[model samples]
Target: MKRKSWMLGVLFVLVILVSYMAKPEKTQNDLLLMNIEALAAGEDYVPIQCIGTGTVDCPLGGKTKFVMIGYSLE
Candidate 1:
């Protein structure tokens, strides 16, 4: 019983670790939405723009430009 419980605990931890590591990194849109949310909450926000070709301008303002690597807008 004790060994079974230990194995279960280890399995649970490994599962959690693998899931965390496999999680996708936040995208530009995600960060933009977060900034918008913060702005809605009366917090200061500096808008960012996309610098590469086929880039979409930030709705808020063009304060900073960023290139979304490995992402294409279709």
Candidate 2:
């Protein structure tokens, strides 16, 4: 009985961990919406000026490690 309970507890923990790990990461659209919301909230917004296949110098100034796959305006 005790061994069975122990195995069930382990299985429960594993399910929780797997669920957490399998959670979908935020997508570009999500990020864009967040940025829009931030802008509407009167927060500072630093738009991405440019993107490259790899790290490249931003036209604004410093270097950036962004590779923009797609973008949408409003």
Candidate 3:
């Protein structure tokens, strides 16, 4: 029983390490769901400081590692 518990603990640790150490997933293909209009408001230029990809859903699909900087009129 103790050995089995130890094995399970080790398995859990390995899974966690694999996930954390793995590189961030990406979408090489252009996601049609993403567009300028969806990102911006109007003629205003949105200051996007940083952005990252996610699960690739739609309409801001998936998770976004994004940060806003400032705004302006485009």
Candidate 4:
């Protein structure tokens, strides 16, 4: 029971953090979405982007290389 409660608390914290991180100020588009994913080592990964605010521009379907050596250091 104790472990279950602790797990629940942790999950609650995680959800709160995720929501807090995603929460952004109101902009012109009414909906702004941002997604970030870590690329796999030695593998090519593409970034999925959605633009809402006109202030910043993002490249659609952008690709980034993840080197194993560099990722381990960070």
Q: Per model, how many backbone clashes are there? A: 0, 0, 4, 0
Ten-residue region with minimum lDDT total, candidate 1: 63-72
lDDT of 3 by residue, 31-51 (tens): 554565466654444544546
- Compared with the true structure, all predictions reach lDDT values of 0.67, 0.72, 0.64, 0.54
Q: Give candidate 3's error at residue 35 in angstroms.
A: 19
Residues 39-73, candidate 2, lDDT per residue (tens digit)? 88863444555554446766566667663334445
Question: Which structure is stronger by TM-score: 2 or 3?
Answer: 2
- Residue 47: error of model 1 in Å? 25
Query: Which number leads on lDDT?
Result: 2
Q: Which residue runs of candidate 4 sit more than 4 Å off their true CA positions?
A: 25-74
Q: Sort by lDDT, best first: what order?
A: 2, 1, 3, 4
Q: 1 or 4: which has the higher lDDT?
A: 1
**Which wins on TM-score, candidate 1 or candidate 4?**
1
> Higher-TM-score candidate among 1 and 3?
1
lDDT of 4 at 32: 27
Flag regions of model 3 displaced more than 4 Å. Answer: 25-74
lDDT-superior candidate, 3 or 4: 3
**Which prediction has more favorable TM-score, 2 or 4?**
2
Worst 10 residues of 4 by lDDT: 31-40
- Screening candidate 3 with a backbone cut-off below 3 angstroms (N, C-alpha, C), the clashing residue pairs are 43-74, 44-74, 45-72, 58-61
TM-score of candidate 4 to 2 decimals: 0.33
